[model samples]
Target: MTATLDHQPIHSWLTDMDGVLVHEEAALPGAAEFIAALQQYGRPFLVLTNNSIFTPRDLRARLSRSGIDIPEESIWTSALATARFLAEQKPGAAAYVIGEAGLTSAMHEEGFILADSDVEFVVLGETRTYSFEAITRAIRLITGGAKFIATNPDVSGPSAEGPLPATGAVAAMITAATGIRPYYVGKPNPLMMRTALNRIGAHSETSIMIGDRMDTDVKSGLEAGMRSVLVLTGSTQEHELTKYPYRPTAVLDGIADVVPLVEQLTPHESVELDED
Candidate 1:
């Protein structure tokens, strides 16, 4: 399809990885081509994901294994955002984390001490092994007045085998146990969106947030004052858009459409149109 007059070129693009860029171990249809086109145009963009199980470097390696080679700096995960938030809120504070190496490593890098005693925060993410004792400890920390923090609230995510419980499920368990709400740092949260924009060095008006989820990605962008696009490659189905409370500025089948739209404009025009 040709670019429309009303079609504004996006300056900086933030895209979800699992469904929009890749599905499981394979790059989604048109994903590589779309990214190649963007790189050729010398546009700035970042791969933003809610998955906190892996660090950006780890994610880059995995993506490379899937034939989607990207630099580590170009990737951001909820784990990184959560770590930054914690660092700002309580730098060097003791934390009781219920997550994998990514979450723990991120907190450590942020100068937060991981401990169970006198913990200032109880952070939760996707954990491969969630023992009863771990849950009990997390509850203990929260009950003792530690602040609760969640990476993302997604209950489940898509995998090569099938859908699996996401970090939000664990977060929910902690919430149910302690009757405490968590400060979430993933998509749908304004903090993550702001961090992504800051990393890209782009103003909200000149950036576009693209994802498949209305509640997280689209809502987060709208709340952050950025233009949003919804793609129908992941969790969101076409028929469900009408019922979603949050709406995006544009909708397409995938990032493939974005390439053509962006290709039609010069770099200057792209920035101008996005700023509008």
Candidate 2:
């Protein structure tokens, strides 16, 4: 457990899952207690994530497996926002996707038609099978006047071996081959942030976004007009904050520190310090 800091009253919160809640199948230290504090206070929050590999239900199930029980509706994923964008931009239009089952299912559910030929849009997300044929097809479609869309611009994701290339790598390949840029729909993009706020029915002034990445999560919150808190449990390091163009409203070691800060700000809650 970590010590908390003094903070202002926060009515709602938006958090990133991979680093703040759990690293893999195991829950992070003090994650359970942090969640319990939120539940006890009845604070409305949403677990917003940039990983489009899984659906909300799938993510909720994974969290449950780790003893973090969160409702499905409270889980907002990049896939859902990306699909919604596609539906609004080109209704009933054909799209060629290079993502996993989650992205494909989301688009289909949004009433977008999947076309094997003559695709108007080429959507890119994370996929295990990055075959040569698929890349060739995406290149051909883009050359034939198709618009490109990317779920996120993140180049890599954390793995046991370290960071591994993600959708951004594939998008880069397509861009190099087709000479076109993709419109991002994930974190750091206002679209995903707006979708999260809408789902939680939270006002920008009263909401706070907490995450480990500065470029994606913190930047997204700042751009969306919400308070941003950067946690040093994953991608970001304490020393790197000075190099970034933007800064978070607050900084902490992890989610555990957030509880005391929130409790300090709220009138009826009390906090006591204990060394682990």
Candidate 3:
């Protein structure tokens, strides 16, 4: 059950939330066991998601309803990463924010002012209600020379019915009108992974990233110098592996398979959690 990458034992974990652990409000096979194992072993870990619609507290409640007991502090969303990035880039900056509570809450916590006129940035995040008036306003603001920032680059998000237009899709529309591309702060940028690592005080050399997507999760983990594992419980299929030039460090059937690996992680002196 000892999981090692490049002969180094893994002491920390970064896992994608939806596909690898749950699907449509249902916990995937062995997900609970994987989390339980991590908790039992005192391994530092974080549940990552590109979805910016809900806050960590909201996500924790949702997961708890599904019988997964993830702590609110253990959940990391694209909204939080975006907020952290912006806080470092420009403290107390004014922004024209377009998103839900998750995005807005993070911005407010970082001391960002959400306004319409004379903003320094136009921040975009995922929301079920994509208002035409809001999108138009975002386009106008960006056209007026405000820097564009998006939570994630996911073009579409999965729902009970089917795929829904997400941040990337809206960002594309804004880009088309303003001739400016948005700075995405979520997965595939590696900034998200790095930030999560920093939050847990974990190093990339001894951490593992588990995700269901090859494009975002695996790619970001690989770039961040962590071991990447692709689980087939989500979007990317086994056959689709041939399409990507880069491969994950390991491929498994689902998060259930990762439970045993958690028990095998090398022991660390202390578990650190970033409160700020």
Candidate 1 error regions (>4 Å): 1-9, 270-276
Candidate 2 Cα errors over 4 Å, as ranges: 1-9, 261-276
Question: TM-score for each prediction?
Answer: 0.91, 0.90, 0.94
Q: What residue pairs are clashing in model 1?
A: none
* Candidate 3 local lDDT, 66-136, one digit each (tens): 88999999999999999999999999999999999999999999999999989999999999999999999
lDDT of 2 by residue, 164-186 (tens): 88989888988998889999999
> TM-score of model 2 relative to the true fold?
0.90
Error (Å) of candidate 3 at residue 218 is 0.3
lDDT of 1: 0.81
Clashes per candidate (backbone, < 3 Å): 0, 0, 0
- Using TM-score as the measure, which candidate wins? 3
Question: Candidate 3, TM-score vs. the true structure?
Answer: 0.94
For all candidates in order, the CA lDDT equals 0.81, 0.82, 0.90
On lDDT, the candidate that comes out on top is 3
